[model samples]
Every structure is written in structure tokens, then in C-alpha cells.
Target chain A: MLYELWILAISSLVAATCGIVGTFLVLRRIAMVADAISHTVLLGIVGAFLVSQTLEGPLMLIGAAVVGLATTYFIQVLDNAGVPADAAIGVVFTSLFSVGVILVSLYARDVHLDVDHVLMGDISFAPFHTIEWNGIPMGPQAFWVILAVFIIDLALILLLYKEFKITSFDPALAAALGIPVTLIHYLLMTMVSITAVASFDAVGAILVVALLIVPPATAYLLTEKLSRMIIVSALTGVAAAVTGYYTAKYFNVSIAGCIASAAGALFLIAFLFSPSQGILLRGRQRKKAAAPASS
Target chain B: MQEWLQFLSSPNLQWVMAGAALLGLASGVVGSFVLLRKESLVGDAMAHAALPGICLGFLVFGRETLALMGGAALTGLLAVYAIRAVHSQSKIKQDAAIGIVLSVFFGFGIVLLTMITNGSYSQSSGIDEFIFGQAASLVGADVQILIASALVLLILSFLFFKELKLLIFDPLFAGGIGLPIRFLNALLSSMVVLVVITGIQTVGVILMAALLITPAVTARYWTDRLGVMAVLSGLIGGLSGAVGALLSSTISGLPTGPVIVVTATAFFLISFLFAPQRGILFRMMETRKNTQFVLNNFLLDTMYEKLEKRYAAGQYSALFSRRELEEQTRLPRNGLEKTIQALQKQGLLTQTDGKYVLTGTGLAYAYDSSLLRRIQDIHLTHEAELGSWKEASANGDLRKPRDYLMNERIHSLLTAEQKLPVSLAIKQSSIEYADQA
Candidate 1:
């Protein structure tokens, strides 16, 4: 029961962190870059492991962040050179990921890291990797790490709320007003990288992308206001984490996988039933509008 | 040498090589259309979404390749449908929709994979090979299936080539022509799914997209025609596949999928840097040449304008110093010197001591160019009734405008309307204005 609580806390924190940063990504229409980053960060993890001979410190986060930014940079370069955006993203991420896989197969074969672990991270083991604070168990290390990330992200968003909002809504206006659009973009990308790194330990790499994209996308259908959207996105992510945990327990399957699946389910529900943007609701409204027009 | 010989003769390795090459060829042809339609990542999502279908196929039918591929095709098409539904039905964009479908379906597949792994299924051991793709595990039956699928895909693509091209390039027009746009779209989507199904066992889900994307993209750097691009992409993909298979076999612990991706990326880098027209290096050279050409033209125009007054004064051999030309044009000193040297080399200008003058050929060239410039000015100033000036301006050579809008008739029309001032008078006034400034 205690371990389950820790798992819940860790995974929920992971989802919430991902949702907060992912809202910006989805809004910016760069959600696939989130997918690219999640995959290439495996290379970062492997590279960091080789250098530090460990995977437990800030180095891993830094490595993932560096590679995440590099992924964006490469994609931008290709985009500037007239490569289609999808092809640019597809080629860059897949090539980088292949390199990462090759590196893992070659050098880090004996280590705890492997491609499968990177893909489907074992979140059930999160509770066992606890941290010690002055001879006291301070819960799972992943929980603290995710909490710190969540707090830092929230604070950053709070501080730069106006800048982020302007950039997201109207970048040209933001640039006209002398806001550093590129700086904000990379800053958000860095935040996403950190959040992805933090979440991947709990939900694995690919599912971290699900957490990043699905909840925010679902919330986008529900609300028009940015603040409400963020709150709703985080709540949706948390709800998925809880329900996904219980569902995984019921089915005796992978928890991270179930969490992502649950997030998808929530998105489907909002897609069909949201008051403002749901397909069914909009269809009914359109029909009523058309009825008056016919009279 | 010994290992190479053995690898070539080995039947199993030959099957693996053939399988990978066919997979690459089929995907390359199909992927060209996908890339052109801007649905590259949609292919990626479908590839990832195939996992759960493979798992379900395993659970239901138990290790039958045909059943597994059938399930994969169903689910892959479903993923495409889901992406379209999400994108059209909500405010969500296509990229986000693709990301959602990709990760969620993949996540559910992982859950199923875990269930199968922990279950009492006997043959569940080899199934995980579909993740990273163990080429060594590919048997003869798999190779034959891969070959057959590749042929079917190739033939379908060929038969529907025109329809698919129209759909990709101009779908609205295709629909207007009553070409069953939606059916063609579904056909393309199914082709993508078929490619993904055949490729999943070779390249795996995670990197299967590379086989579809890289070669097509690389071929794009080399050509603009869709037919040629499709062929080139297929050839490049096939070559990369064969090379990747051979290299992976030689190197222990190297997976065939990543090796193939790396090989395709290498091809992409090569084309990116060295293709004839679109390559980065070629573009850079073209830019440099364009800059030099523009500088040369500027130098010639400046020299002719300066020497025109002296020529009008009947001192046709008159000269101006490099410093005067530099001050007049305000071009960078180094560029000015290079342009001057190039003009001299082309026999467009003559240099005596430290001064320069336009030769006879150069004077004639500059006069035509200057006349074109003045006529353009007149056309712009009198915007109405000068629509023909745009066609004249489209002429590259100053002499060619005479065939369009610069003939004596148009010149007389302009002069009668007082739009074309006396050429000598205009130059004299501009010189006077220059002196005053």
C-alpha cells in the first residue's frame, strides 16, 4: 500500500509536469518535436552514463536537455533549408535515435540501460529507489525530482506568464513589442526537455510524449482560456495517472503503458463530449442554427 | 575476404538481405508520395500504432505472420483514421494528433506486450524482436512474405501512379475531375500501412519511419519530378538496405534496423551536401556566383554612367580612376577591385595606368542596360497604360525589350506623352543633381 502511494505520487507528478509544459508545445504546433525529444533523450542518457558512469544525477537531465535543444536546432536548420517540416523532424529524430541505439548496443550493453528499458520504462520500480535525507527515507527519488521540476516549471511560467502568453498567441506582436521570441521558444523547449526527462523515469520515454501531448490536447478542447486550460490539462493528467494505475493493477500489465492509454481515453471522451468544442455538441448547435436559417 | 565470400554464399543471409532490400524499395516508392503529401510523421504514427495489433494478432492466432500482418494493417489504418478524426473534429493540429495516436497506441501495445511476456505463452520470446528488430531471427517464410508484399506494393503504386500524383499535388482538382479522392486517399493510407507492416519486422516500430523518410527526402534533394524522385528514392533505399544488411552481418552486436537507418542517413547527408542543384554546397556556390554577377553588372553600369558624359562631350577615350568609381558606386573596395578585374578580363573595360574606361563592346552593352533601366523608371512612374512594360521588363537582355515594348513605336508613344524625357537631357540633369548633392 505504501509503495503504491509512492508510485501514484511519482507518476502523477510526472504527468502533471508533462501537462504543464506540453500545453505550450501543443499550442505552438510543435507537438511532434516533443515526440522526437523523448526518443533522442535515450541517446543523452546513454552519453551521460558513459561520461559519469552513473544515471542518478543532474548530468542525465543536462544531457537530455542538450540533446533536446539540438533536436530542435537540427529540425530548424532542415526547415530553413526547405525540407518539409514532417520529414525534417522524422529524419533528424530517427537518425539520432538510431545512433543512440547503436551506442547502447555497442558500449552500454552491460549497463542497466537498454533500448527496451528506454522505450517501456519500468515505473513499478520507482518506489524502491528512495532517497535518504539525514538518515530518513524521503520517499522515492523520482517523486522529489519530479516535484522539483514541477515547482521550477510552475514558477518560471508564473514569472514569464505574460511573455509566454504573448508569444504563444501572437508571436509577431510579441516580436514587435521587442519580446525575444526565440529566447522564449528555447526556454520553453528546455522546460519541456526537463519535464520529459523527469517523467520518462515514471512513464517511460514514449509515454512521456503521450503525457505531454494528450492531456493538453484534451484540455484544449475543453477550455478557451490559457490558465484554465493549463489547470484542466494538469487535472486531466493527474486523473489519468490515478485511473491508469488502478487499470494496470486490474489487468496486470505495464503501468506506464496503461497511463498513456488512459490519457488517450480521456482525450477521446473530451473530443466527443466537451461542451465548447465536442463534435457532438457542435453538430447539434450547427443543426439548430441551420433550422432557424431554413425558417 | 573470407567472411565476405561466406556472407555472399550463405542462403540465410541472402534471404535476410533480399528481405531488407525489398522492404526498403517498397517503402521508398510509397514514402515519396507520403513525403510529398507532408504526411511523413503520419507514417511514423502508424508504424508505432502497429504494435498493439501485432500483439493482439499474437494473442489470437499465435505466431502466424499473415494474421499478424492483417491485424497490423487494420490497426495501422485505424490510427490514420483516428488522427484525421482528432485533427478535423477538434482544434488540435495534425502534428499533435499524430503524436497522441502514436504514443497512446504504442503505450497500449507495450501493456499488451508485457502481458504476453508475463503470460504462459510459449512463443512469446521471439515477439519482442519486433521492437528492435532482430534480422537474424527472420526465417525463410518471412522473407518470402516480404518479397511478395513488396511486389504487390510496387505494382499497385505503378498502376495508381497518376491518380496518386494528382491526389497529392492537387486533391481539389482531382476531386473535381471525379477521381474518387477519398478512395485514393484511403489507398495511399493503406499502402503506408502495408509498408509499415512489412517493415516492422526489419526496421522495427521505433525507427521504421527512417526507412520511409530518409531515402525519399534524399532523393528530393536530387530531383523535382515526382516520377524520377520515386525511382531514385527506391534505388537509394534498396542500396542502403543491402549495405546495412551486409554491414550489420559483419559487425557483431549491431542491429540491422539501426544500421540501415544510419546508412540511409549517410546517404541523406551525402545528398544534402553534394547534390547538383539543391545541395547546400551547390547553393552556396550559386549564391557566390550570383553575388559576383551582380557586382560585375553594378561595376559596368557605374563605369558606363560615368564615362557617358565624356563620350557625349566627344572625348570617347576618356577615363575615370578606380577611386572615383568606388566613391560613385559605394561598393565595398575589395568587391569593386574584383569586379573591375573581372570586367577587364572579359574585355568589357580597358585599364590605362590607374584609370578605367568602357570599351566599344562594353559601351554598347551598358547603353542597352541603361536604356532598359530608364524605360522601367518611366513605366513605374506612369503605372496606367504601361501594362506592356512588365512584359518588357521580363526580358533578360536590354536588347530583347526592343522586341516587346521598347520598339520605336512605343518609344515614340512615350516621348509624345512626355513620359520619356530626352535621354541626353535626363542624364545632364541627373549629373547636375549629382554635382549639387
Candidate 2:
């Protein structure tokens, strides 16, 4: 029982890792794009499989991440060249997914990726498919890969500190400084893709989207600073994952559904009560802003 | 062809096609303005929100028949009105309001559905197709409803054309001019709801948004004029519906709605590539043409004037060095070098005299259309007006409404004692309006 709980703990940590990266994604209003990336990563999976016969963790992660980044980069590049962001996203992802579907049909007799499996994770089955090195369990590959990606995200933030801030906050100013705003966009997008694909094995594709978006969005409702938002989102995500997993176990219901619902609940809490960015709360703020001062 | 003819003539398929065409035409016409308003995806949310309406309808009527469907449609219209109310009365954003309405309404619908299933009323149909989209279930009455709805929307749109344009493009100006912008705004939102409900029997919600958006977006690439955009969008949409209907009939397992969406996407790709003004092929050809003209002039005036010699790289290279070349004269450096290389390939200029002499073909291309430059600029600005309009609208500027509206209001309300003008002028977002896009 303790071991099962530990496994759940590791899974939540992975969720937290996804949430940390997701904060910026929601902040830049690229949450739907994150959803599109999750749907479109099948192309990268097929590409990876064509190159390497196995679904060995690192190979799949890198392949998916690269494709994810490329997708985001092209979308932004087209948007910059006068295409609206949503239209560009719609164009790129649907076209790529069509190609992916064609390839998936042409290459394999039976499609390996199940849509149901992609929508929801099977935690009971997750424990069975384990890998180890010599003596240590290395926890689960889901946990470690997400952690490594999280670390890489932190490193990228550290190195390109000023550029990410400027680009995310004010692209015009960033462009004025001659910082390759486009390059930073691609870099951040690549990280998003990597994080998406990394935890994908544990929590299917669509739920990964729900995870990536909901926590960061909830965090957005709570705070403003980059670092603080990241931390808050991660913590919130981890808490939700734990509560959600146990709730699923208790109810004998859908793990993904529970997690998504819990994250949605967190969003509602913030929506109802958050000081500045909440929906109803923001209306109050607006009313206050518009009010004349008392003498 | 015979089988397809028979199929097209068949009543069921006829119902499907009519449903598709009506939904397509209405969405095309209404969606053009919706896309212009950037409320494209609000349809998608309303589609989902219509679930509670469906559930409620089913609850009252005891099935998924026409009356229940009407109830669902009413719910969708009300949701759209609510969206307008929230956006107008409050500071909630369009997208966020959509998200809020989508989840809450859908969540309630789900709960209602769960309760219905729990009770004796589990005989619901069309819910499956309602989530994605199902174009196969349209019967005769459904077809009639779609056609009537489309006709109503078209009639209303024509009657309210000038008012709709003003409200969509310059709400502030319309408001200032004492035109019931709120009523017109509600009217447009209601039209979108009408489009979605008409679509529910055909496209459903998830892909319905794409249908509403994609044709309008594709049409946007082709024309600056809103009327042309509306007509073109309707054409694209109708064609896609026809194709989707035909293809889905041929294929056994394919769903009607997705196939229709895919077909629309095909039209979009075609527009992106083949549209005369903003297309990929046109842009590329224009760029090539511009370069060729400058090269031809450079060859005729610069290299050709020099001597009867195979021009060498060094001498005519001066013609290539200038950064800004006139449209008819010497080309810019990059284009000049490319042309010189082509000329060299044709044995015209290859370091024979240290100058780039144009090939006869290259020179001919340059001289072929000296007047093309002015033509090209006209196309470029006109081709991308959607972005320009979006930016301009976001800029919130108005140049010609204060006098017209204020005086109209003063005259109408004070002198005429018009209650409508005073009541209509009670909006805060109406700061001003600029000229047309």
C-alpha cells in the first residue's frame, strides 16, 4: 500500500513538472496551441518509430519534442508574417495530423496508438510496465523524464532569462533589443513539446493537455510573477494530482477524468476568489478601477 | 454517375444535401461577419451550451424529435444573447465568457442528461452526433427548418446590412449616430445561434466552429470587400457540403460532419494556394515578376547599351550593387545578381567583359510589364485587409460619428421626444468609430 502511494507520489511530481512549464504557456495565451501540440505529436511518434524500432524513452521524447517545437515555431513564424495565431495553429496542426493519419495507416497494419488510451491513463497498468537499472527502480520513467525536462526548462530560463521575459511580456520591445524573439519562442515551444511527450506515456495525450493547461491557468488566476507563478502552479498541480488519483482509486472511476475535474475545481476556486485575475473577482476589480475616488 | 444521380435524387440524401447546403449558406453568410467580429469560436461554445437546451428539450418532449430540437435551438439562441449581454454589460472578454458559458452550460446539460437517464426518460437520440457533428440524421422537417432558418437569416441580414456593418466595424460610431447598435449586435449574435442550431442537424458543435470559421478565413484571403467575402464564403461552404455529402455517401464508415469539415479544409488550402491576390502562387509569381522587370531594364539600358559582347561579371556588377533599384530601371542587388546568373546561363553575361548582361528572355521579361509594379501594390494592401481591420478595430478610433450621432440623438430625443434613442444610447463601449476598412 505504501509502495502504491509512493508510485502515486511520483506521478503527481510528474504532473507538477508539467504544470511548472504550463504557466508560461497559459500566460502567453497559448493554451489551445498546447492542446493542438498534444494532438499533433503522433507524427513525431511515427517519425521516431520509423527511425528507431523501439519506443525506448529518450528517443520518443526527443522526437516528439523536436516536432512539437517545429510546429510551434512555424505557427508563430506564420503569425508574424501576417497570419492570425489561431488560424495558423488550425492550419499547421490539422495539416500535420492529416499527414500523420495517412502515415499511420500506410506504415502499420494495426494502429498502435489507441485514442481511448490517449484520452485516459491506466494507472493499474502503469505499474506493470516498469524498467530498472542494475539495482534501483529509478522510480518510474514518467517521473524521471519529466524531472529531467523540468530541470532543462529551469536551465533554459536561467540562460535566456532576459530574452524570455521580454519576448513573453513585450515582443515589440524584445524585437527592438535585437534579441531573437523568434528563436526564444521556438525554444520555449520545444520545451513545451518535450514536457508534453515526456509524461505522455503515463497520462495519455489529451489529459496531458488538460494537465498542462489547467494548473498553469489556475496559477495565472492566482499570481503574476514568472517564478512565483511557476512554483504556485507546480504545487497546485501536484496537490491536484494526488487528490485526484486517490479520488479515482476510491471511486473506481476514471483517473484522467478525476484529475481534470479536480484541476477544473481549482480553477473555479481561483475564479470565484482570486484577488485580481479571477472572472467574477476581476469584474469587481474593474468596477473598483472605474469608480471615482472619495474626497 | 448513375448511382450518384439516383442517390442525389433519393429523399434521404436529398434531405442531407439540403440540410448541408442551408446550414452551409447561412453559416457562410453569418460566419463572414462573425469572423469579422472575431466571435468565430463563440459558435462552438454555444453549440456545446446547447446541450442543456437539448436535455431540457428532451425532458419536456420525451424524445429527440423536432420540438425537442427547437427547444435546443432556443437554448442556443438564449446562450448567444447571454454572451452579448455579458460582453456588453460587463468587462468579461468574449473568449473567457465563451469558456465560462461553455463549461457551466454543458456541465448542467450533462447533469440533466444523467438525471434523465437515471429516470424513465432515457430515450434520447442525436446526442452522440451533437457532440462532434452528424449530418446523416436530417429528415424532411429538419431540411425544412434549415432552409427556413437560412432564408430568415439572409432576409434579416439584407434588411440590416448597413446597420450590421456599422455595428460590426464601428460600434462606437453606430452608437454615437444613435443607431440601435445593441439591437443589431443582439441580432447578429442571434443569427450566429441560428446558424449553429441549423448546423446541429448536420455538422454538430466541435467541427461546426471550424465550418463557421474556416470558410470565412479562406474567403478573407481572397477579397477585401465584405460582400464579396460573404458570397465567396457561401460558395466555398456550399461546395464543401456537396463534396462532403458525396464522399460520405461513397464511404461506409466515414461520418458526414468530419468529411464536410475536411472538404472545407481542402477548399481553404486551395484558397491559400490559388486565390488570385493573397495566394501562395500569386505572391511567389509577383515577387519573381518584380525581380524580372528590374533585370530586363538593367540589361536593356546598362549591359545592352555598352557593346555587342558577352557581358562579364565585373563590369555590370555595378548595376547589381545598388540597394534600392527603381521598378523599371536597374533591379536591386539580390534580384540583379540572380538575373545576371540566368543571363549567364543563357550565354549573355559570364565574365566575358566583366559585366552582367541579361539574357534576351530575361530582358524581355523586364520590359514585358513595366506598369505591373503599381498593379502589384494595389493587390498587396487589398489582399490582407482582415489583419488590417482587426488591428484598426482594436485601435478603437472613430473619425465621423460624434456629430452625426450626437445631433441625431439631440434632435431625435429632445425635439421628437424619442425614447428609443435615449434608451439605445445607454452604452459605455461606444467611444468612437473610424472610417471603413
Candidate 3:
């Protein structure tokens, strides 16, 4: 039972961090870049592990952050060089991910890093890898990693709230006001990279994309204000994390997959039933508009 | 080399290679249209969306390849439509809608896959290979399906070549000319779906978009003509596919899908750096040459002006020391020497007693100011015309006067309450403006 709670706490923390960072991603219309970063960060982790010979080192996060920034930088370079944005993203991330997969298969075959686990993380076993200090158990290692990432993300968002807002909303105006728009953009991508790496072991790389994009998108539908969107998205992420955990336990399926599915389900609910932007509400509004004309 | 020949001679390897090549050709052809339409990632969304369809086909119709392909095609088309519908109906933009549909459909597919694996389906064990693709597992019948589908896609694309080109380059113009644009769009989208479905088995759903867009983008660097780009893209795709297959066969445990994608990326990198006109090397060369030309022109014109000033002051000899020339041109010492050497080689300058003097040819070239003045006059007139046109358009002076009367009539037809609020807001704002004045 305690194990179950730790899993829930880790998953919720991962989801919430993804939600907070993903709010800006969605607003900036680069949510797909988050998808790209999640995929390529695998290369960074595998490379880091190969060099450091340890999975529990800080090098993994640093390497993943570097690769993540490299992905964004390459995508930008390609875009500036006349390749379309989507094609650039498609090319860079797919190639990096392929390199990572090949590396895992070739060099790291004896290591714990398998392609399957990279694709679909095993959250159930996360609690067994506990973190200890001074011979006292703190919590699951995954939990602490995500807790640190969550705090960093929260602090960054708070400290740079105004810069992030202006840069995301209108980069040109922000640039005119000397806000270092490009620096802010890279900083956001760096945070995304860190969040993706922290959540990767728990949710896997592919589903981490789902965690990063889905809840924030659902929150976007539910609210009009950015602050409310952030809060709602974080809440939605936590709710999905808890519900998906229980659902997966009941069904004996993959926990990360279930959490992603639950996030999608929440998005569907918001899509269909959100009071202001819901499909049903729009349909009713259309019907009401046509009623007077019909008479 | 002998081992490679033996491996190539194997019938199963040949079949896999053939299937991969054909898949590449079809996707490359369809991908050109996708790239031109700026819908490159739509292929990715469709690929992810096809997962549930694959599972559904397995659950309902067993593990027949044709049944699975049909199911995947159906869902792929559904996903495209869903993306369109979501963005069109809601406030969601296209990218967000794509993200939504991709994750949701993929997540749902995972759910179905897990359910099937847990259920009593004996053939469900190897279905997970579809996630990363296991081209080695493809049998003879699968090869035949790939060949037939690829051929059909190629034939259909060739038949509608002009129409596709028009749709890609200028859809609004195509619509203006009374073409069946909506049908053409639907046809092209379905063709993309067809290519994606056929290619997914060899490259997997995750990397199928790479096979679709990479070769096409790489080919774009080598040519400007669409026809040439399409053929080159297809050839590059086919080559990457064959190479990837051969390498995967030679190496143990290297997945064919990622190998193929990496091979295509390799091709892209080579083209990006090495192609003649559009490649990075050539672009850099062109920029260097342009900068050299500008610098040379500025230096020569500066020398000419300085000589002219001396001539106007009654000094006929257009001679100046290297230091004086450098001061006049503001060029660094080495640059001044190089420019003077280049000018001397071109018979535009001469060195007499350590002083640079303009030759007759250089003097004549410098005196040719009429060409520059004419170019400046044309530019000035063009700017004036543009300015007048913008003012005229802004003031509505070029519009039909009757259009304004019609607009005013429509405005008057609104209810008094409707007009009152708008007029009141205008009045309030104008009153504030008056107070500020």
C-alpha cells in the first residue's frame, strides 16, 4: 500500500511538472516541439549512462538538457535555412531518436537501458529504487528526482513569469522592450528538457509527450486566463495521475499508458462539456441563433 | 564482398529489399505533395492514429495483412478528418488539434493493445513489433501487397500530376479556375494515407514520417523544378531503403526501421552540405563572392571620387599613395593592397613610384555615373508610386463610391439599439480625445 502511494506521488509530480511547462508550450504553439524533445532526450540519457556507468547520476539530466537544446537549436537552424518548421522538427528528432535506439542496441546491450523500457517506462517498479540519506529512507529515487524538477520548474515559472509571458505572447514586442526573447525561449526549452528527463523513467519518453501536451491542452479549453489555465492544468494532471494509477492497478495494465489515456479522457471531457468553449455549448448557441430566424 | 553478394542473392532478403524500395518510392512521391502543402506532420499524426485501427483489425478480422492495412487506412483518413473538424469547429488551432488527436488516438491505441494482449488472443504476441517495425518478419505475401499498393499510388499520382501541382502551388488560384479543389485535396490526402499505411510495416508508425519528408526535403536542395525534385526524391528514398535493408541484414539486431530513417537522414545531410546551388557550401560561396563584389565596388568608387575631387581642384594626375588610398577608402592595409592588385590586374589601376594611379579605363569607369543616377531615379519613382498607391488604398479613393453608399445603407438597416452602442462608444472616445487636445 505504501508502495502504491509512492508510485502515485511520483506520477502526479511528473504529470504536474509536465503540465506547468506544457502550458507555455501550448500557448506558444510549439507543443509538438515538446514531443520532439521527449523523444531525442533518450539519446542524451543513453550517452550519459554509457559514459558515467551509472543511472543515478546528474549527468543524465545534463546530457538530456544538452540534447534537448540541440534539438531546438537544430530545428531553428533548419527553419531559418528555409526548411519548413514541421519538416525540420520531423527530421532532427527522428534522426536523433534513431541514433539513440541504435546506441542502446549496440553499445549498451548489457546495461539496464533497453529500447522497450525507453519507449514504455515501468512505473510500478519505481518505488523499489528508494533514495536514502544517512541510512534513512527519504522516498523513491524517482520521487525525489521529480520533486526537485517540480520545484525548479515552479521557481523558474514564478521568477520569470513576466518574461515568459511576454516572450510567448508577442516575441517581437518583447524584443523591442529588450526582454531577451531568444534567451527566454531557450530557457523554456531547457526546462522542458529537464522536465522530460525527470519524468522519462516513470512515464517513458513517448507518453511523456502525452503528459506534456494533453493536460495543458485540456486546461486551455477550460479557462481563458493563463494563471487559471496553469492551476487547472496542474490539478487536471494530478487528477489523471491518481485516477490512471488506480485504473491501471485494477486492470493490471501499464501505469504510464493508463495515465496518458486518462489525460486524453479529461481533454475529451473538456472538449465536449466545458461551459464556455464546449462543443455542446456551441451547438446550443447555434440552435438558439437559428430559432428566432426560423419563426 | 563475397558475403555481401551471398546475402543479396538470398531470396528472402531480396523480397524485403524490394518491398522497402517500393515503399520508399511511393512515400517519396506522396510526400512531395505533403511537403508542398505544408502538411508534413500530418503524415506523423496519421501514422500514430493508425495504431488503433491495426489493433481493431486484428481483433475483428484476425492477423491478415490486407485486413490490417484496410483498417489502418480507414483510421488514418478518419484522423485527418478529425484534425480538420476539430480545428474548424472549435477555437483550437491546427497544431494544437494535431497534438490533441495524435496523443489521444495513440493513447487509446495503447489501451486497446494492452487489452488485447491481456485477452485470449494467441496471435497477439508479435503485434507489438508494429511499434518499431520488424521488416525481417515480412513474408512474401506482404511484399506483394507493398509492390501492388506502391504501383497503384505511383500510377494515380502520375495521372493527376498537373492537378496536384496546381493544388500545391496555388490552391486559391486553382479554386478560382473552377477546379474540383476539395475533391483534389481529399484525393491527395487519401493517397498520403495509402503511402503511410503501406510504408508503416517496413519503417514503423513512429518513423514513417521520416521516410515521407526526409527524402523529399533532401531532394529539394538539389533542384528547383518540381518534376526533378519528385524523381530525385523517389530515387533517394529507394536508395536509402535498399541500403538500410542491406545493412540491417548484415548487422545483427539493428532494427530496419530506424536504420532506414538514419540512412535517409544521412542522405539529407549530404545533400544539405554538398548540393550545388542550394547547399550550404554553395550558399556560403555565393555570399562571399557578393561581399567581395560590394567591397571592390566601394573601394573603386572611393578612389574615383577622391581623384575627381583632386581633378576639380586642378590636379590632373590621379595619383595617391597607399596610405592616402587607405585613408580615403577606410579599408585595412592588406585589403587595400589586395584591392589595388585586383584593380591593376583588371587594367583599372597602375602603380608608379609607390603611388597608385587610376588608369584610363578606371577613369572612364569612374566617370560613368549616369547609370547609377538612372538606377536611383527608377528606385525613387518606384517608391513614390508605392507610397501613392498605399495612400489611395487607405483613403478608399480608388474604390467605387457606390460601395460606400451600400455599406452605409447596410449600417442604417441595423436596429437603433445596435447603432446606439457603437455611436456612443465612438462619441465617448472622441470626447476623451477632445479633452486631451
Q: Relative to the true structure, how large is the alpha-carbon lDDT of every model?
A: 0.87, 0.65, 0.83
Across B1-437, the per-residue lDDT of candidate 3 in tens digits comes to: 99768878999899888888888888888888889888988898999888888988998998888788888888899989988977886677777778777877776677678878988987788777777888877778888888888889889888999999999999999999998999998999899889888888777888888988999999999888788888888998898888898888888978888898899999999988888988888899999878766666677768766654554465545567888877888888887777777778888777777877656556555434322332334334665533443564478643442232234433354334322322333333343344334
Error of 2 at B407 (Å): 44
Model 1 vs. true fold: TM: 0.93
Question: For candidate 2, lDDT tens digit of each residue in B167-237?
Answer: 87998999999999768877887788778876876775545676677788888998998889898888888
**Candidate 1 segments exceeding 4 Å error:** B307-317, B388-390, B395-437
lDDT of 3 at A68: 98
For candidate 3 chain B, the 10 contiguous residues with the lowest summed lDDT are B417-426
CA lDDT, candidate 2, residue B434: 12
Q: Give per-residue CA lDDT, model 1, range A10-63, as digits (tens).
A: 888888889988999999999999999999998888888999999889998899
Task: Report how far off residue B201 is in candidate 3 (Å).
Answer: 1.8
Candidate 3 residue-wise lDDT at A220: 90
TM-score of predicted model 3? Answer: 0.89
Candidate 2 deviates by what RMSD? 15.4
Query: How far is B188's C-alpha from truth in model 1 (Å)?
Result: 1.2
Model 1 chain B — which ten-residue stretch has the worst lDDT?
Answer: B416-425
